[model samples]
Target: MFVHPAALCESDQIGPRTRVWAFAHVLPGAVVGADCNICDHAFVESRVRLGDRVTVKNNVALFNGLTVGDDVFLGPNAVFTNDYNPRASVKKTEDDLLPTVIRDGATIGANATIVCGVTIGENAFIGAGTVVIRDVPPGAMVVGNPARHIGWMCACGRRLDADLACACGTHHGADPTTGGIVADDA
Candidate 1:
């Protein structure tokens, strides 16, 4: 892992080829995966788990109980909360903090606030400035303050058509179990 001179990465578990940029602070006990790019001014607290090829942009704060899957894109200024009912006077343990999961290939847009205990499914796209209060289905595109599902997103990051077809030659169908979109060949 390449940690910039101005960055403070106290974790010894960062994977190979990961770069922690300037002004970023990755505390001890954080597990960062290979080829991850943690940009400037980002704060990764202990107990966070990041998968390979993740991109954490500038000004993002990833608190405890966050598990980010491979190829996830966390846009600039994205905020992740661990506690749903936070109080300055109350000191909560790890068990008291709710866990948030960002599945593989998901993209969290800039300034988005992801509330605790939500599972963002694979390849989900969260629009900029959106507030996510619940679980997001796979291949779904969400926006606005409560994170309404506006449309479907292809794994290549394009908006899918009404028939769930993409110009990239991918076809998606609904998964009955999760009520989420899934690639036909997946």
Candidate 2:
């Protein structure tokens, strides 16, 4: 039940356990689900919709036309822009707006900037400080700017080894090698 002084919202769909922190604003038409944490200084625009168990950390902004699925972890300082190309003096129309979607169970690390019109797949993990300009596949793990898929990640956010396996049951059990896990399945 923690409410920040700077957050202004009139949305009626906020879940029970969600906390809105300092300087964070959820606009009137935003829909946020249960147990989501909107951390410090985050801005969620009116058209943004967040599903259950989403975690939006400090300094993150979800502009209009963004849809975040359930169990998504948006790391600190992550940014999403609704426009693909913009000049400081240009006025864009709704037709020019792009939608950014983060699928279920995705984890975006700190300082990641996801460009418009990208759909991050389910359970994909994007490392910190990465810049994503393309769609990320499900269960994939990517890092660095323009984010190349380096490996696969478990739904738990553990990076799978080169053997396409981990100590976790996911390594040698159900859900094997689905996230572009390439290498020896040792």
True-structure RMSD, every candidate: 0.5, 3.6
Model 1 compared with the native: what TM-score?
Answer: 0.99
lDDT of 2 at 48: 92
Q: Rate the local accuracy (lDDT) of all candidates.
A: 0.98, 0.84
Q: What is the TM-score (0 to 1) of candidate 2? A: 0.88
Candidate 1 Cα errors over 4 Å, as ranges: none
Stretches > 4 Å off in candidate 2:
171-186
By summed lDDT, the worst window of 10 consecutive residues in model 2 runs over: 177-186
- Return the TM-score for each candidate structure: 0.99, 0.88
> Compared with the true structure, what per-residue lDDT tens digits does model 2 show for residues 1-186?
456777776677788888998778888889999899999889988889999999999999999889999999999999898998888899987678999899999999999999999999888899999999999887788899879988778766677766656656565333443433322352
How would you encode candidate 1's per-residue C-alpha lDDT over 1-186 as one tens digit per residue?
Answer: 799999999999999999999999999999999999999999999999999999999999999999999999999999999999999999999999999999999999999999999999999999999999999999999999989999999999999999999999999999998879999999
